[model samples]
Target: MENANVLIVFVSAILLFCIAFSRLITKAGIPVLVFFIFAGMIMGSEGAGGIYFDNASAASSIGNFALCYIIFAGGMATSWKSAREVLLPGALLSTAGVMITAILVGVAAHFLLGLTLMQGLLLGSVVSCTDAASVFSILRSNNMNLKAPLAPLLELESSSNDPAAYMLTITIISLMKSDGGGFFGYALMFVMQLAVGAGLGFAFGFAGALLINRIRLNSDGLYPVVAATIASFVFAAVQLMRGNGLLGVYIAAMVMGNVKLVHKTSLVRFFDGFSWLMQILVFVTLGLLVFPSQLRAVWLPALVMSAALMFLIRPAAVFITLSGFKYPLKAKLFVSWVGLRGASSIVFATYALTEGIQNADTIFNMVFFISLTSVIIQGSMLTPVASMLGQLDKEDKTLVSRSFTDYEEDIQGTLYELRVVRGSKAVGMAVSDMKFPESVRIMLIKRGESTIAPTGKTLIKEGDTLMVTTGKTEALLALKERLALV
Candidate 1:
């Protein structure tokens, strides 16, 4: 009981500090994720906080758990219509691009860092995929609006590309444990992992959407809880079935997000906040897992590797994989610059340490250093880079803008006024008789400039302006029908 209380207080304080300081960090043109990570390092065992956390296995577990929420929330927020525009490009980036980046980086590591081919490949794989949490948080928090389909392309690639990186890391680890396999064998494994992961992801995603929309729980609050539990189950079941759990959960959330569920507004809001919490937890826990003293030995190699990844390798992958597409040179360059390695890379590095691979400590430290470098360099410069490449959107100055802004959390439905004219069935009807959609609320009635707080018994006469607080589609459709419009 005592320990639990202490844990609660410690975690609460950390969360509060991070949340409170985020505003200040964002104002300074820095990504708040950097602050969260730095806060963890400062509070770590070697730092002032003296909180010791060196369990690789435990950190990995927490990371995977956090990823479930992070990925799902990302999917839930994705606009499918926009995703369709960049589907082909996003697919290539997430798959072929990952392979190219991994292989090239692997070669560089082998030649420059003096590691074996397989070990170098393993190191490459650890940091191959851009971490979605860091990317999304930075882009959104900064209110960045990229031109055309670039935003969705980046989001879709980041959210879906982790499986490729994970597969490569694990495959290389398997190769290291045994004699390396033939080309055909390795290729087959890659195809199977992707095929299985994607197949199960879509299947589970569709099923979750159907289930959420059909099932009606007694309480609205329970809907978010139910959705969250189902998402976690999707991940676990996929893993058990030898598929990619992260991919499955993300796809599932995307599916659920598109469908009209019972309490969708609440669900999105819940997951949005929940995802941020998980990000803080994952990054901080990763920070605690590392000892700052060890980073000194690998900083040089880390710097070279980070530069190779940010410049040569990532750009090559983006350009080569996207050559067939019609995107402008600027758009492609912007995509290359957005390749920020983050929590997932660090999390995967722990796999090396836990598996007892050769130079696991060195691999972990290098990955940690490189990920930080990516965040500090690429993350900090995303807006300016996009601006320099002429890819930043000029119309919207807001930190973030969603296509479906009405459905966004913290944004209330618009207060719209609808007038009931002649030739309307609602010409002499009571507000209660109109039977508005459950989501629509009639807030006031304006008859001859006499503003009235409408009650169910209030009559809605012709020329009356009904002030409503509801979604546009629901309110407009309901008003059209109620007013007997042709």
Candidate 2:
């Protein structure tokens, strides 16, 4: 118990410091993830704190759990409307693009680094997918508001591609351990994972949406708790059934996100913060698992592989996969540039080590170095690169965008603050009776200290503060007149 207390205190201190340090790093055009990784390195065994950790399995376990929340949050935040436009191209990027990148990298690794074809392919598969945590964190934290379609495309690809990457990683590992079944077996396995995963995800997501809307929790805080727990259960169940749990959780969350649930805003807010906490924990844990000294042996190879991935392989994959699509040249280029290797790559690298592969340590160190360089170089320059491609949205002066609401770009409306006055048409009337103009809605009503979501049946009291959104200035003026706004 005494040792446990000390352990808790030490962890708590690290969390507090790292969370605060994130703010400091953001101003320097650096990715906060890079800082978190370095922080863990400083506190690691080889560094000042000297805490020894070489557990690949434990790190992988924590990473899987962290991934569930991060992917779920990304899914929940995705607006179906925006995703609809880029669905085909995005799906192509996530699936075929990952495969292409992995194959190219695998071939390069096999020839250049003297690794076995299987081992090289395994390395490729692990690092193929763009990381949701890295993309979400860097883009949202830095306010890199990429223009429409591009943002959703990238988001969808990042959140959805992990399952493909995971499939390839596990499949290659299986092949390495046996007298391999041919391409037919591998193809069948991929189909099975995706099909079963999607089916289960849809079923659970529908059930979750129904439960969230119907179940009246004792406290509002419990809403997010219940939703998240159910989502985790979906992941566990799907994995137990030999399906891709990561993919299942993401699709499930996407389903839940598109539906209206009780405490929707608060639940979204809670998950947003919760996901950030998990990312920090996962990255730091991964950092602790690495020994900087081991990195020295693989640095040169790692640098060469990283260069191939960032320049040759990634670009070729993106351009080829998106060839027949309607996206502009600049969008394709931007997509290729933003392919930042992150937590998933590092986490997947541990699979090789856990399997006791001969080259596991070398693979792990190379992956770690590659992820670090990717985030430090590509992640830091996302905004500038997007700007060069003319794909970035102008900074919005009105809404103070939080990560949760960063993707709320579709609601193109002018927000108006209005106060209800005595004897106005709106006062002492139900919100439904107010007959708000078309494209105008009362999003929130603040009556003194309490805030209401402004249901149709809710009465509008005098002196209440109303936050209304309207599509046109005329509609706002009409609302002002009816409400007798001061």
Off by over 4 Å in 2: 1-10, 395-486
lDDT of 2 by residue, 1-486 (tens): 997788668767876787788877665556687777876887799976678898999999999998889888878887776788888988998899999989999999999999998889999999999987777767766656566667778878988899899999988887887775677887798889999999999999989999998997788778888988987899999999989998899889888888766666667778889998888888889989989988989999999999999989999999999999878899899999989889889988998888888788999999999999988888778878889999775642121133224333235588778888877778788989888885776777877876665555668888898898877988788778766776
C-alpha TM-score for every candidate: 0.82, 0.83
Model 2 Cα shift for residue 384 (angstroms): 1.9
Candidate 1 per-residue lDDT over residues 371-399, each given as its tens digit: 98898888778888888999876754322
Q: Tell me the RMSD of model 1 versus the true structure.
A: 8.5
Error of 2 at 426 (Å): 24
Model 2 has an lDDT value of 0.83
lDDT of each: 0.81, 0.83
Task: Judging by TM-score against the true structure, name the best candidate.
Answer: 2
lDDT (Cα, 0-100) at 145 in candidate 2: 56
Q: Let me know the TM-score candidate 2 reaches against the reference structure.
A: 0.83
Kindly report which residue pairs in candidate 1 clash with one another.
143-399, 143-400
